[model samples]
Target: MIPQKLEVLEQTEHKLVLVIEGISLEMINALRRIMLTEVPVMAIDEVIILKNDSPLYDEIISHRLGLIPLKTDLDVYKLPQECECGGFGCPLCQVSLTCEVSNATNAPLMIYSRDLKSNDPKINPVDPNIPIVKIDKNDKVIIEAYAILGLAKEHAKWQAVSNVAYRHYPLVEFDESSLKNPELNSLIVKMCPEKLFTMSNNNTLKLKDDYWRYCTLCMSCKNNSEGKITVSPKEDVYIFSIESDGVLEFKALLGQLFKIFNEKIDEFITNLEDLEIES
Candidate 1:
């Protein structure tokens, strides 16, 4: 059967939210952890292609980190001459911006790293201000932004400047006892083409949160000739929030859509495999 891509459920300048109808927070958090960590942090990742629509097309991979706008490295942006504190307070090394987030119940709070900003000539921020958003609260949303210039990795101070993304899989939950007796976890493990399923020493089969990034959501894991397992996506729980300086655009919209698509494809593949095994 031909697979179908769902329509854009919702969009925003900095976020895109969707519903998968019966998933779980545990599963969603699991998927988020994997996608955020495993997705590649390519130096140049985002590609914006303008089509017939005013918003344009923003294609993205969960693994793809933010783009490096500069063609060269940071040395080029440094001030040529020396300073009183030597390298301290150099104008070439800093830029400032603002960002704010409000009532982001559906999405997790994320911020960019400031230190890694590339010195490449082509690199430029659409907004000179940085991301400033409050997380998980309402009534007078939180707002903050400071100079986004630095080069340290893993330091919280460096995080003010780079865009990061979460994993793309819809949260799915299943009751293994709903399948067959002695629920064969091996059946689910074998169903994954991505090798996401694993067996524990205890002999109980449980879905690894890390594997969510690879989940095709094919529903093969759901197939139980003996009626022992039940799996479903959490669609009713919808959460939407984004914080950005500009108006909503395609990059933000499509980037999120791709994440949704990745999970759907996994589901389709898994479901198809499960059905085949039953047949």
Candidate 2:
């Protein structure tokens, strides 16, 4: 099969949008599943509570910690199960974080994810505003947590992508000449939920590309226009978007995804070759 062509439309540290052509729907969906469940990320796996004066129990606090997204460095870290240390616990396989808070103020104090101090400066909470728990005056909470690289299949806390999905590229066509009537043009604008259509100075109906991805293909404009407007999807092209959990940059995540895909393909080919030889 010929290699697919990928064109990045927009990219940021946490979000990515791309146009992939010359690929089958099955291949695109497989990549989406891999991004959701196969990509490894660092998250709290173990917690040790030395003291607790808050309302939340030790187990509850530990569970909350596990859900917090932590920035990941794939180059420097290895999954505990795959590590040569036999899953015992090593700097390369696990990261240590400590949270110690003693509320001495007159009012209640809220503990946030930022309060958790990490031994490795590179690995920390993605958002500092996430609230862990609240403690009353003169109350205190002490805890130690261990983070390790893990896959989303084991737990959702390890999921690196939040909104990962793809859809067929939309194709919109409308007859500008038919839209000469001001009332019809106004109706078209009001019918579009995405507001993708606009009136130009030449009294022609124009479509904006900015919100085309948001189109639901409801065909409200087309149906009301007496067949003047048409909406369809491109068969071989897809628009893909992904929002990361900040554990890994979106670009790096895509790189890792392609690497994993290539490895799986190679393994499948090797297995097929062996079976043919046996036959």
Candidate 3:
């Protein structure tokens, strides 16, 4: 058993920063290989439609695994419990959809997604019980609509209530008297990597409240400023709820493993005593 715990922290996207304690370089490499190859580990997140037709899979498997869409009420129905972020239910931060299908001769349906959601009559088989379609008598087609899981914490799915995101570091504001040349706004604009800061028609430097989501908190904006720029996140923010698919929560799994290991160790020690002579 390893001496110290492996701290897994959420990084960006589907990647994680694993800080191993008291492990040698050789052991780290060996552990990494074992985890990747042996463990059925995945970074939990919302389902992303990378491609309607992921070429990586066969048509049948793709239909079953990736084709069918997942819809849930987490986006629509508000939770009775008060959210950590104090905001009433807002549609911009939450939404829901239903995916229903039935009666298909073929396995993978090459249907257009935009067309499915945009029909004027709101499409047929909208009811929860009705099948989107019906195929054969014995093999009834089924519609599977539920909240998607199994994506990285960094994936957009990890948002508080929905897949919405905001800047980790907001703009910092300072007073106008602090700069050598208060008239020039070019320096402030140049400091932003996402080009979020711009000069208003009134000649005062302006930041877009809507575009703040792109800010990555690199500190360039703060470094270039001489004075008088008030950097802060937009006051109103939305929250989303997300759940994991038994992945990315490796710590819990590690705990289970340790419990089993101790049990086995006790059994081994007991067996060894049987071979010893009575003292």
Candidate 4:
């Protein structure tokens, strides 16, 4: 039951770094893959362009709209396929966004995400300033789009997170006594691309105090040090980092990941139980 533990190494508005222990490489990778594909986020899937006066075509405008990230409320919406409306347009599974812009000024006007108003106040573009298109004076555009909760498996625009990755925690081994030449020590310290190593006041190589937090395990130091340094991955430990595009909060993303993970496990167990096997 106590198979894994996790600690946050760094946290920011758009990025998170974590140290995970007691988990196998396979398990950690599974989590990453799920976050990249299975978690659902709201994205524009259907568009109705009633009028267009801009230089961009209707299809191009639709594509641009699909890529805009929208704020998601996991509790308030359901995936279309899983909705009680049987994937039909319904309040529970879809939100409508409309954009109607007319350039009255003499100068060219740029259409922004803020120009599109959503029927539901809870779901709108994450960034108000994302440019959709530019229209000349007297140009008018009218559009209606539908946003629905979907998985990245269907389209990348629905992906919940970006830069989802995990790497093994690095372990560096070396002895100062093995290398007598100061020149070699200097080379070893300079070879690390992450700058994880530094020369101490006594002319010995020293790893940074929080090297584990930044080490990429590139093995640059080990390769150039002529066997004086050893760099390898520590077993059963990993560093995981994920970046968000602000569509969904990190908390919501992780919550959705576990919910989907558990459902898969339960399904696998039930299928195995119902299967007949020859002894």
Highest TM-score, which number?
4
TM-score of 4: 0.96
Comparing 3 with 4 on TM-score, the higher-scoring candidate is: 4
Give one digit per residue, the lDDT tens place, for model 4 in 125-228.
99999999999999999999999999999899999997799888989888877865678888888878888888877787888888977888888888888978
**lDDT (0 to 1) per candidate:** 0.39, 0.89, 0.38, 0.91
Q: Which candidate is the best by lDDT?
A: 4
Error of 2 at 261 (Å): 0.7
Off by over 4 Å in 4: 1-4
Q: Mark the regions of model 2 whose C-alpha exceeds 4 Å error after superposition.
A: 1-5, 178-184, 200-203, 209-211, 276-279
lDDT for each residue of candidate 3 in 1-279, tens digit (9 for 90 to 100): 453554443444323344344545454444433333322221111233322222233344323333233332232223223333333323322222333333245454333333233111221221223222223322322222222322223333322222212122244565533443534567778768889877766556666774544665566667676435545643322111122232333354344335444655798899998886777
The TM-scores, one per candidate, come to 0.26, 0.90, 0.29, 0.96
Assess candidate 2 and give its TM-score to the true structure. Answer: 0.90
Model 1, span 73-191: residue lDDT tens:
23334322232335443445433222222344564443333322333323444443333222333322222222323322422222222333333444556564443333467666776
- Residue-level error in angstroms, candidate 4, position 221: 2.1
Better of 1 and 4 by lDDT: 4
